[model samples]
Target: MKGTFPIEKFSHLSTPFYYYDTQLLRDTLFEINKEAGRHNFHVHYAVKANANNRILSIIRENGLGADCVSGGEIKAALKAGFPADKIVFAGVGKADWEINLGFDAGIFCFNVESVPELDVINELSAAKNMVAPIALRVNPNIDAHTHHYITTGLNENKFGISLSHLDQVLDHLSELKNIRLLGLHFHIGSQITDMDAFKSLCIRINEIQEHLYQRMLIVDIINVGGGLGVDYENPDRNSIPDFHHYFETFYKHLKLRPKQKLHFELGRAVVCQSGSLITKVLYVKEGVNKKFVIVDAGMTDLIRPALYQAYHKIENITSDKIEEEYDVVGPICESSDCFGKIVSLNQTQRGDIIALRSAGAYGEIMASQYNCRSLPKAYYSDDL
Candidate 1:
């Protein structure tokens, strides 16, 4: 590592915790701000990926809005000091209380996924005697070019409203007095590496926008949901994603109307590389067929590996010995608890501090209390 981290100092106090490099986070945010400013784009940090209080505060300080998916998330964003006007609530199946909560909070707008959902919001807003502004999430049927599990823009997915139903939506728009359409929204998938997928989405958005404009629809906002992935295999080489390429893809392909503010809801790319999951080797066992390194940090601390078969660089930060092959695993009861199988790392021993790199996103935020484990505490470099 180019920068030194005092692993020895924290090894005595905790076996598993999240370590954040605030400097790297600031640099990533600066890149996002610089590029987004050039295009006059508005960004909302997707809180579903990572909502740690400190991390949320840092992201809020960057002046990006909060994209929340649930009622609890909206409450969390507010509790974290995100302005109501800068918060956007979205989900396919929002609860009645959740819609009422957003209505009371007066958030920016609800990203409505279905015509039925639109009716529900209108009903809720009508109950409160309030007009609710919304953006219709349009199903573009474009491939996200990522893992099959994450791709949501296809017709098979139950995410956004299909193009076949737009006529129905337009039919109801006149009747829904409490609902006001702001613009269109689209999100294909998460962790997409192919820039062409985004370009395809832009072309489709253009087609949709043109069709809507022909129907006398005035577009005020265009929300392209965030699914930008980051480099996990080589975290050292690419701590942050190429903001230039990402933004340029949109700038070149997306046809925008005058004064139409483009909104991006990014989560992973902004925070993934700046954090690491620090765990200590609880035991090292060598069997005839395999060598196993048991880590205190299980899938409970970071579930991306188990959930998405995701990869994060492993490092023996506290060891100086030669490398060896071992299957790094956590104490979880499930067979999927293995972090990496037959991975080569420094000759690890009991109590060696291990670091799982590129875990800044979907790491701590996805953590659960399974196996009766308490959530891991987080430490920032600024605090150290």
Candidate 2:
């Protein structure tokens, strides 16, 4: 299913902006809710993925919870209509003000990552004469088989409490009167395409659960943080991710106690395919050995390619000419500002509209004003 672009309408607008297929986004959310609803699972949309106001509004309308990692994200989720009770805050280094904000908002839970954070939250909750609900983010040490930078569940990663330190954390929990233990949270990594990695996590979680059971500490929630990957290379073919399989994986493998709720913090897989970075070809510079297709958008607009060496399918939507290989480079001073190498696109030329596919997740949210370039504005398909 090749995505349809309103080239006529796009021609009148400025280049280097984000284009979101709202219909596709709605469809994706529908599929996610349908599958998860069957098992009565809870999903929190990780706002770090894409915090666009419109995007957050649409997601809030779909009845999903919000997963925030910062004070700003918590506020954004609230402003976008997500219920405070349906929000969960998670981060390795949460400041005092951020913890106070979460407490003030009365979010569902704080995925506490360290003992110091737990102490701060307990102290803050006590200050307000409240009991802060929290879930210990346990590091299962399972490799998500993703980029090293994005992996969070490993033992060395500073994201979660290690198994070796779980007893100590539990001991500290007993002393915190204002902090209530709600459950356990585990996030292996992001961009995890392998289902077996998740299966392994379930097994690990079961083992951890057994240990907790032995200690007579039973939790009512089990939040397996989301890392479901999307089909970046073939977005049109697999626009909506395999939610059925993803949900079923947990249903089949995870050993949940009766009436215990399962939670997920999905970011990329939920919104990655519904948005694209639209850039106009500024110049087609031909070199002796290679051809460079320079575009106005650079690393400042979409940094995944340069930062993570990520791949996004680039298409010359404005041309119907014969295909040829061209290096898609951006107008940034940095040499790493390139999108792809030897990309196959229609015989490209200046003013050609290019669509960087599968960028809805980390694309716009991570945009920067580097080189003093203006941030990319976003337009929805319905609005266009």
Candidate 3:
């Protein structure tokens, strides 16, 4: 089924823009709170997903914390009114300035990815005469069964510290006086639909906890990084992810210590379904074998289809004449600018408005100016 769009409003605006349903976003946040609150789990929205100013403000207003991977995202989160105590800085290569920025802001904790990173944070924190709170991002090596590019928990991925080095890292942590280990963090990958992967992550975390317990190391938080995937093909049917099952999987499998908090960094699942890449058909080219519907929006606006071979349900929202199949493409100079091959839609025309479903997560945030094209502007339903 097609998502509801403000066709009249879209017609008045420029082509190749993002249309966000704020009500749907709010509803999704409500479901996240309702489910996570059941287990008293703390959730921080991963700011790398969609960092639009208004979107960030709405998410902050909903009481969810922020999980940032860069200094700029931290600044954005702070500018949006998220409490400093509720933001967690995480990244593999955090510059010295970024670490200092975190210390200056007194952010909650840093998810340290390596022993060297730990030492750097320690040194930086010591320079400021402060104790830096940190969480060790351990690599559990669990396969998330997702795309290779997004899979981060494997031993080969350069994400978290390897399990084999955890003990050594812990031993080294004992020597650092300016850094305090606050928790453990794990993230397998993104767009994961399988609950077993998370269950596996829980089992691995339990084993790690037991090992830590043997060393009398009891941390205060267990942050199972978010990989909950939404239904991209059927966005209207499953607008919000299955948070009930996702959280329940952790509650049943993962064992938590008393007074220990469970944290989650969710990015895509929180915002993906409420957005669509709205573009106007620029031209229709008749090929020998098939027809092509060229859109004004290129890979610059939404690159997932070209980058990851990702699929987004395409619909001709302005037409209802009949059904036909056409290869939907963009006007980019590259051959990889295709959106969908042999996509079936209502008899499309040159001026029909097309809605690319489930783009709220990485759509506008990842837009580029590769072809010197202007960045797509975003319009929210509330304002429209």
Candidate 4:
């Protein structure tokens, strides 16, 4: 469904702020939990997607665990009422303090990416006289068929351990006594719409599991890191992703050993549709060759367009006048601050409220103050 924006309510509020549909967010969470529960699967909400306190609280209420990538995320998750045991820390570069924090918090697992990281965790765990539970993040080298910037499973990507070095990494396991190896982790990439990529990953996981079994390395968890894509262009049609098919894909293709638990670290698909970046038109400049609809918001408010050339469905919520094509550009100093090129919107005018849909994921969280812009404040649908 096309999202409803309270244009009257927004009239008094400042421009360049986020509006979150809490009902939509809760609905999405319910669907995710229902689907994952069917297969006895576990879900850890990736905090890197959107760490808004309200968003995190709603997710925690749904009983989904936290998939934290940093110490701050862990603290945020904990502060938001997510149980410490439900937190799983995963990052390629976990500093000394972060690793120690994870150990101190007693998180579910640390998705270890390298031998040196494993050693550091071991050392830190040994200091605390505790055994750190960890899962080796293996590089399956499975092509996720996504943007090169978001792809992480390939050997060239520095995110996970290469298959070639797995044997050597396993060999060091016995030498490191403070960390207990729990399972294997595989995150192919982000915004993966293709089921074939995940199917390939499942097959690769099977092979890897068999090899590990031969070596007597029995794992209890199989964390297929989540990269489920949301329909950015048609957020209304597919507001909630097909979680049933996503979970079933694994059930059908992945051969899980008797009692192994399946885990997912979903980020974008969880929060992307529930939010919209609301901006106000500053001017409608008529250039010689092109018309520009300049907005008050800039790359500082939402950088996905400039950073990834990402497309967000833009709409003129205030005006129902005849639509026209105009380049939707932001008021940033950089030339790359444009949101969309030749965008069709309601007959443009100054002071028209524009809603950039499918911006809930990486929009506000990634906002920077490059030009000393004020951080965007978030408003909730229920509150209004």
Candidate 5:
């Protein structure tokens, strides 16, 4: 709670907007950097997490690189003063223009997913008379044990190169003139709560690396892409993701060869706890044996709840009243736009300031205007 949203400060502004905790973000980055240094591992700040200019600047200042999923993200990272050499571009379907843009920017590497994608990058690099370094994003077929929608490393997830295609990938790599294969990449999923799932991922990665080393050589980097989730249930209890356990899991379980770098693309874990969607309660509707607290914010402002049925601890920052059971809803038209079902909060009233805790990761980055609602504005504590 960097300087406590200061309800008085926002009394003049709009009802719905994002308030950020830069202090928490700074502390999270410090922990990540400290832990990453212990194992000589590298972390790329996933741009899709927040992409707020201030957050990007703060992350870049801490020497964490950028993990971009789109051309716009790459541009935003560059505009925010992140060095081009520290950036990595990865996506399931990268357009031709995006590839050329990254190539031109001289980005660190492209986490190539499909075979056709590999060919396209090779062709593009050859046209530019350059050899592009790439990491083969492998579909490890391991259950991330998270949401089905966010699970990416499974065989059916439509994300990376399958295990069956490794031989073909090697053969194609030998033929491609402009693509240099350096490492293997795996991203199981996002917002994963189970540490055992990551341990299982490390086991799968070890087996895959052993199999690949036995067949082929020249592997250097082992990129276990980041899915270490934060405690959304108790944001105050744990503002920072368990970096100690996250890094220790890989340090203990992952088998790293001499001089090989381990890379992680941490997104939500690094920033989720430092953000909140500040909304004002518009009305309190009393119903049969139930109560409803409707806020001015909607699914358009923070879609994780409506889109993925995600949960966040909600608090009425302005009210000191006793607790009550209420269905926390948004101003959106659809029934699916509700934030929480039967959440327990203090007795609320009109104009009560509510903090949707742990929204820093996918909150501001996912704002939209589906119902012609103006996109939510963002404010930083360091500025205000």
Candidate 6:
């Protein structure tokens, strides 16, 4: 089934823009709160996904914390009115200025990825005569069974510290007077669908916790970074992710200490369903073997298809005729600018409106000015 779109309204606006269903966004956030609140789990919206100013404000209003990976993201979260105490800074390579920024703002904690990074944060904090709170990001080596580029939990990935070095890092933490180890963090990957992968992560974390317990070290937090996947093919069928099952997997498997808090950093699942890349068909070319529907929007606007070979449901929102197979492509100079090959859509015309479903996550945030094309403008449902 096709998603509901305001075809009349879309016709009046310029082509190649973004349209967000704000009501759907609110409903998704409500579901997240209701499910996570059941277990008293703290969730921080991953700011790397859809960092639009208005989107950030609405998410902040929903009472979700912010999980940022860069200094700019931290600034954006702070500007959106998220409390400093509710923001967590996380990244593999955080510059001195970024660490100072976190210390200045007094953010919750830093998810330190490496020993060198920890040392830098410690030195920077010591220079300011302040103690910095940190959580060690441990590499569990569990396979997320997703794409290689997004898989980060494995030892080969340069995201978190390896398990073999965890004990040494824990020992070294004592010497750094300016750094206080607050917790442990683990993130397998993004767009993970199998619950068993998370189940494995829980088991690994439990083992690590036991190891820490044996050393007489009990951290106050266990942050299992988010990798919840959404239904991209059937956005209408599943507007929201299976949060109950996702949270329950961790709750049932992960064992926590007394007064210990469980944190999550969710990005895609929170906003993927509420957005669509609205583009107009600039031309319909008839090929010898197949027809092509060329769109005005290119990789400059939405690069997921070309970048990750990702799939987004393509719908001719303005058509009511029979379905036909057509290769939907963009006007970008690169040959990889194809959105979908042999995509079946209703009989499309040169000016028919097309909606690329489930693009709220990494869509607009990853858009580039390649080919010197202008960035796409975003319009919300309420504003319309």
- List ranges where model 3 is wrong by over 4 Å: none
Backbone clashes, candidate 2:
0
Q: For candidate 6, lDDT tens digit of each residue in 126-193?
A: 99999999999999999999989899999999999999999899888889999999999999999999
Error of 6 at 189 (Å): 0.4
In model 4, what lDDT does residue 39 have?
93
TM-score of 2: 0.99
Q: What's the TM-score of every candidate structure?
A: 0.97, 0.99, 0.99, 0.99, 0.97, 0.99
lDDT of 5 by residue, 80-187 (tens): 999999898999889999999999998999999988999999999999999999999999898988889999988988899888998888888889889998788899
lDDT per residue for candidate 2 within 1-384, as digits (tens), equals 346899999999998999999999999999999999999999999999999999999999999999999999999999999999999999998999998998888899999999999998888899999999999999999999899999999998989999999999999899999999999999999998889999999999999999999999899999999999999999999999999999999999999988899999999988999999999999999899999999999999999999999999999998989999999999999999999999999999999999999999999999999988899999999988
Assess candidate 5 and give its TM-score to the true structure.
0.97
Model 1 steric clash pairs: none
In model 2, what is the error at residue 218, expressed in angstroms?
0.5
Candidate 3 per-residue lDDT, tens place, 157-204, comes to 999999999999999999999999999999999999999999999999
Candidate that beats the other on TM-score, 1 or 4, i.e. the better one = 4
Which residue window of length 10 is worst by lDDT in model 1?
1-10
Candidate 1 lDDT over 288-383, as tens digits, reads 999999999999998988988888888888877888999999999999998998889889999888899988888998899998999999999888
User: Which whole-number lDDT from 0 to 100 does residue 23 have in model 1?
Assistant: 92
